[model samples]
Target: MMEFTHTASFNGHCTTLPLSSNNVTLDPTVKDKWGRPALRTTFMNHPDDIATMKFFMERSMELMDAAGAIKKVGSYAENGQTGGVHLLGTCRMGNDPATSVVDRYNRSHDVPNLFMVDGGSMVTSGRGQPTMTIMALAFRAADHLIQAARRGEV
Candidate 1:
């Protein structure tokens, strides 16, 4: 029998305030083969992320020690994990237009019926994983949008 496990920690919550750091913009001078503007991504791992990974590494090593591991080999220090597989918070949802791209219900503040239900609507990343939360939000957004449409509120 074989068992596999990973020792990693992730926080979707960035230390930098929303609408302050990280962004995606189209390169005005560049275009795709289809004549569409190319996207320019700008992101850097925050210090808090490094700290969190280090903390998790320490805890993992302690667990290994308790498990009576004779040889421990891994480095979560110096070079911590960078970025994330679960991209989020691109179009943050908020009450203030200046700070967010979508409203609380995942509806675009600028477009009445425009709804953005995805990881992008998250204002902050949760700890480690966000797929479940993203799915739940999608359901909630759909329900709200359906109700709004029925009531002619959209």
Candidate 2:
């Protein structure tokens, strides 16, 4: 007698549209222990995002059927995303201070000495992992900072 086991899984990711309403703000009524306003996050999935999640679920089911799986189970948020997995696109990067938080080099537009080289500086979340991209941005920002320091710009 012989025994064998096989398993497969599929995970799909979708790019979310940016909305001004989805943002982090300081809570006017809530204060932290340090006397600063507490951070309040407002987020809701767009209609397109919900549709994309449904599409991915359907595709995953099809793939499972095509693989002749004996049993399969899949689920997605029917209403909207309840929680976030990858936290990206918080501090958007752009050339204009009026529209974005960070500049092209990941430097804070409002604060000259502050640099944001993490996922928060991304303008949009990619459909894949952002680790490598964040690393690259950090390296680039570091290089720019070094050059700026050399020029006595800091």
Candidate 3:
């Protein structure tokens, strides 16, 4: 005789607010083999993010119970998330150069003819995947670049 069993899992994601402390900066002491400064990343989830995670975890537990799960186990980060899958909001896009790295069109405020059309330019990560948003931004930046070139701006 043969037996079969099944298992399921769920994951929840929430948007995190922008914090001045969470950033990526050039390491003053560390350098790569090419002598360029290594990138240093610092991140910590906000209290609201932790609370949202807890809420989702509780909901998932209830769902499992309603599904008549024979056995269940669940856990969430009580303190905060140590790391994340999406790397976003590194080079924030805004109108002011003092507070942001890129402009509305993803062009570097300090560097001419340079564009940053990646997740780094995002001010915050969305609840869902960012691939489509990133692609849209890239397309928009490309079109802007094309128009600028036509006008001899690039």
Candidate 4:
């Protein structure tokens, strides 16, 4: 990333956003759940959340400089979503088999007994530290696979 270009080496770091109950900045003018309105998403990083990354990189560099430490900061040129990019996509939950490549279980809608998990199942990236959620999804998929195995879907 542009942030890492000027400083110290990375030591295997990763991050996820802190989702607060009041963080939603935009709403679809809809309401639900408790006789009130609701937002489809309360808060989100932009499609390309470069600003957030840039801010973090700046702060990191500032801190390192303040502490008299060497630092190199830059963004990864490839793209921003590398952390969560590998998970979901065409194989996620869908209303119809024709729409999604995978079923709710993330199984290949086209192939029997084959399932995928992780970022590969995501339709959109979350402004999250998705690993925990990704793990949960993987567990759920594994469970579904096991059940399917019991049912002899494999």
Top-TM-score structure, candidate number:
2
Q: State the weakest 10-residue window (summed lDDT) of model 1.
A: 8-17
lDDT of 4 at 27: 48
Error of 1 at 51 (Å): 1.3
Q: List per-prediction Cα lDDT, in the order shown.
A: 0.72, 0.86, 0.86, 0.57
Candidate 3 scores a C-alpha RMSD against the true structure in Å of: 2.4
* Model 1 / residue 30 / CA error / Å: 2.7
Clashing pairs in 1: 12-125, 13-125
Off by over 4 Å in 2: 1-6
The sequence of per-residue lDDT tens digits that candidate 2 reaches over residues 1-154 is 3224577778777767778888999999999999999999988888988889999999999989988988787988878887767788879999999999998789999999999889998746757678899998899999999999999998
**Model 1 regions more than 4 Å off:** 1-19, 77-83
Model 4, 1-154: lDDT tens digits are: 5555554653223333332331433346666767566744443434334555666666766767787875445553225443433333434556577756677777787787677775656654454555787688888889988987899879
lDDT by residue (tens digit), candidate 1, 52-149? 66676677788788877666765653353454466777788889998789987889998988998888887466554678888888888898999999
Q: Name the top lDDT candidate.
A: 3
lDDT of 3: 0.86
TM-score, prediction 1: 0.78
Q: Model 3 — which ten-residue stretch has the worst lDDT?
A: 1-10
- TM accuracy, model 4: 0.44
Total colliding residue pairs, candidate 4: 34
Candidate 1 residue 63 C-alpha distance from true site, Å: 1.3
Candidate 4 has an lDDT of 0.57
